[model samples]
Target: MAGVTAMTVQLNRMDRVSPWGFRLQGGRDFRMALSVKKVEPRSPADGQLHSGDAILAIDGYDASQMTHAQAQQMIRNSGNTLQLTVNKGLFQSLKPTGPIKFSPAAAYGYSHGHSTF
Candidate 1:
């Protein structure tokens, strides 16, 4: 018999540099993209990002086009501020304009939820 152990990190702004806490899951195929699986509370992603949010772009880096590792690296490299182009809903629809941007210096933190995944 074999056993597998998993650990979930409590994403905290003070703990992480980027503070954009979210689980990335996807990139299996063309149809499947690197999307948000879970958004942690008391973190940068808490209020802004929902569960189903297909991270179209992070600081202009396309998640749908890039591999999962690439997207993660981009997010980590974003530092304290992050500019995201996201599609929110059951089905992703690309809008011509309007992007969401958040900086660590802004009014944010604490825990809550409104998951769409």
Candidate 2:
């Protein structure tokens, strides 16, 4: 947890049918991490949450091992009030490197792929 910083956010659902007003990124396939990708303007999470904030838990349940679908379901199931525990620094620490180009022949050493430099 060297780069992790945790904080809690509470969101109030205007009604049963209203949207959560935030978008998420990352999943088992992507990186086994969940992060806030977008916060709709003037929404409940607008000021409380931020893009790239890593979700550490939903309510009191751990979210580190959850898939995107599972996490979504958990949020949806949370009625009225939704409490989130997030790591504001975790996502920044996990930043992706620039695009890497590779050639099929590079594996066999037939041709050297472009260097990251």
lDDT of 1 by residue, 50-96 (tens): 66665666676555677555565676766666667666533342222
Model 1 Cα shift for residue 49 (angstroms): 0.3
Model 2 TM-score, 2 decimals = 0.72
Best by TM-score: 2
**How do the residues 1-117 of candidate 2 rate in per-residue lDDT, one tens digit apiece?**
675668888999788587777877666534558888767877777788887788889998998888776777788888878899998845642443786477454566632211110
Error in Å for residue 73 of model 2: 0.3
CA lDDT, every model vs. true structure = 0.53, 0.71
Which ranges in model 2 have alpha carbons more than 4 Å from their true place?
1-4, 92-117
What are the models' TM-scores? 0.57, 0.72
